[model samples]
Target: MAGIGPAPILFNEFFQMFMRCMPPNGWPVNSKIAVGNSGGPDSTCLLFLLQKLLTDLRSKTMARQSIPTSVVSLSVNHNLQEASHSMAARSAANAAAMGIEHLTLDIPWGTPPFSDKPVASQSMEQVAREARYHVIFDGMARTGAHSVAFGHHADDQVETSLMRLARGTTELGAGGMRRCRRWGMGTGDVEGGLGWVGHHGLDRWIIRPLLDVRKDRILATCEEHQLDYVNDPTNFQPEITLRNAIRQMLTLQEEGKDMVLSLLIITQSALSGLPQHISGSLEKIKVAAADLQETTMDLEGGLHQLHGAVKVLSSRLEDVDNEVTFHLKNLTLPSPPSTLILSSHALPAIVDPTVRLALVLRVMRYVSFHPWGSLRADGNRRRTSIQRIIDTLWQSDGAPPFTAGGGVLWQPAIFSAKKRLRVGTQCLGRRLQLGERFAWMASRLPAVPYNMLDTAILPSKLDIDVTERLASATSRGDDFLEVLFDCRFLVRFDLSQIPEELVEALRKSQETGVNVRIKPHTKYYWPKVVLRKPSCVDIAYATLMDNGQIDTFGHAPWVTMKYIRLLDAT
Candidate 1:
């Protein structure tokens, strides 16, 4: 409001539309958001806009006034350029003028906490991004903020899409930057499948309110308000980086025409198919899949539901506003997932061949951030690697067992007991250290990358320290300690003194054994996965219960000492 150059009505109209990216309605409480303030015109405008929005909301109604929202500006000093420190100082002064607290995070260079250390020849962009997100995560933790806001706008989207096309991207890559996403350690987010779900609101979202605005308007607003910001001279020199080149080229093209808008329209066109709503399609498929049976499940009926869900999902991946994620429940089958055994003699008359091919890509998209794994594939074209796999998946009768991104598996558990296809992450372990870093995920929250560290030592090497921490926290008389293990599960440890009644219940169960969903991922995937903890050995051994076909992905529970004993309790 102070520095915006547009007329009051024009500015109000534009700002209102921009706020739609991540509506304030979804938030249940007054949240403190951390802004990635670079002291640039875009971010500077964002900080000012948030300040105005919070103030305006406070004055609007009783409901809004009750919830107190504040902004904390964090300047990430990568130390890459000589002006980095000065930029941080500039941001701090601006934030102080607006009565918002400002913090500067210095980039750290070393081993364990950081990976992919920058080299001279390698691009510094990724390194700077890593350092920036590291500080952003640190800032979020220190300030107890739930959402981190960035300054990406409409023009950035144009550049991003073009850059992805230049780099040879898959379908997911071409979809452009997300407005809101959950990213971080818990719930396998950093490993894959749209990151974690942190209930405590320790950096769960990256919100972009300025996505609806264009760069020219943004600069105009800054000019009107008399706001001072630094320009990155490197952006003008396109040859320095691919992004810069694309950005410069787009600027030149848009000199006399609306090239950015045209590209975005074309991008939408490329997403293809009518935009599908996600209201009921996925639920229908999940309900049917959950009820699949070998003796009772009508094979034709089940495929019908599965195919429909895949179609709807594929159509809606373009609508980044709709959140899509997947999880698997550990269930036992009559045969190993590596083998395919179908009772159906022929393909269903109603389900077409095209549906089968689309299902593989669509289903893979549902569970993975990169379904095609950075490679372009077309069922109609010279077979790409993923296409070859998909082609095999829809063989004459049905495809054989196959594995893909993030240890994804396609197990045709099609015996008499279960006439359904069981798809889930394979048994390969993903060893992760709690305190280290799942760094790249900070900016792209929720839509996370798949690769995480795989430790070769004992499985406990990753979770042991987490165990100790939970133990220490539990000793402080915490009632129930809930913690996530390796982004796989959200596990809760029973720390309170065991009740005598429950002890008796355990004693009774000890006679027969009770089903336990001890691990966090298991609890998440197998809602009914209750295991019988009859002994320490059984408790330790309780896993996905694979038919000796798959191996554990080193995913284990992180619990306190008392809960470890509970694992032994039936």
Candidate 2:
């Protein structure tokens, strides 16, 4: 029996590891796919492996459900150097030779006018990454690809975790990149959600298929395949970017201390215990929330509410380790008044109007909520008291506004509501209406019952007239028609006018009542309603069935849905 060398053995081991961890349903069988190839060793190796795997699978009679693979290689020419374009051309040629689809996108390199500093000095690494992803996602959409895979190896993950640790990031950030996540494709900040902020329209499904593989294996694979790759010169410049510094440090560790293996071992150890650490911390926080009633509590106030029952829960920071206590301090009470409200307008205002303006702006950015209105809302006497403090601060040129990460504003009328608190933007529910034409078409579908169609499909079928009318009604009047479905088509009814109907539905569904959760002035509300049955089945079936006849939805004979809800602390 012949024994394979370290390189081949490592590659096979990593591939086996991936096979075991893969969703256990094989790769997505029928969706457009894009591969990010930067003419680098890692990506070249990945492309070769994917092509071989796809080809081999196609030859196997048992692999009837193998995805029809059409590989598209995307190269982003950052134009940082004159040779960038030539390198991209070489990559494109290589891809063409392999009979794989290829595209080269050229992006002009420069800092935005507002940030006129050199790219290197102005966090150029992050800036370039944003631009590169923007291009890749745009290409993915143009090709109508469902998933885009990248070649991020174990070394990259180590580097990322190290960087986050160095920067004193929160635990969530330090946890490193997720294996899979939803990508939104739009430019502006998504009004309701967070994560990967920037354009959402260019969003494409991104995956790191090589994350578990080592960089050495990648380089070895490239060598075995006789693939030529371009070395990025910017990576060598240590004066610029922390990544370069980290790479230099890692090189030093390898040469001087044999630290690479030790670091890897330590990282693996950390990874093994990370899940349990996170789980235990979250469980304790949940119990604390149940006892405190509020989702958040003031760190300074030492006040905690117990569920709907208000109670005082306090613990000294010295009792727990700094790492654990720091997180617990950030946790808010879990019930109503979810936000930790802080009042800061009482601070003395600067005497210089310019200074005062700057201070106000800085405060606004620092505090989770505005304090200016809080001062005005207090009765005449309290308002006078706040004004006096402002005048004194202004006259004395007091220190700049205090810095705090998260806190909510307090106003007289806003905080008066029992269950609701006024935050920045409150979202109003807008009822989606199916117009006369849509209703008529929906009522007359062939073979498919009118009620079987999802209400979500109305957006595509809605005519201009219906859209205009809905928009006008939502904008000008409080009452508007909405289509709701139970076993059948529920008639159009005003959202405010149908409280009784919604309550009755909730009762019949054997669930808790629904609540309209608002977010400041935003014109949308997330309705949290308990249903008689798990909505996941309905949602999953609706999505899977909507695409067409699902013979057996993918390789897995069964489907599973995982839901994780993050509370919004205003």
Best by lDDT: 1
- The ten-residue window of minimal lDDT in model 2 covers 436-445
Candidate 1 lDDT over 376-441, as tens digits, reads 112212226456655544344444445444323444322333333232222122222332211000
TM-score of 1: 0.60
TM-score each candidate.
0.60, 0.46
Per-residue lDDT tens digits of candidate 2, residues 384-478?
A: 33333335333322232222111213221122223443322221122223320000000011122234333223321110112232334444655
Off by over 4 Å in 2: 1-5, 9-29, 61-68, 109-118, 184-203, 257-570
* C-alpha RMSD (angstroms) for model 1: 16.1
Worst 10 residues of 1 by lDDT: 561-570
Residue 144, candidate 1: how far off, in angstroms? 1.8
Clashes of each: 22, 37
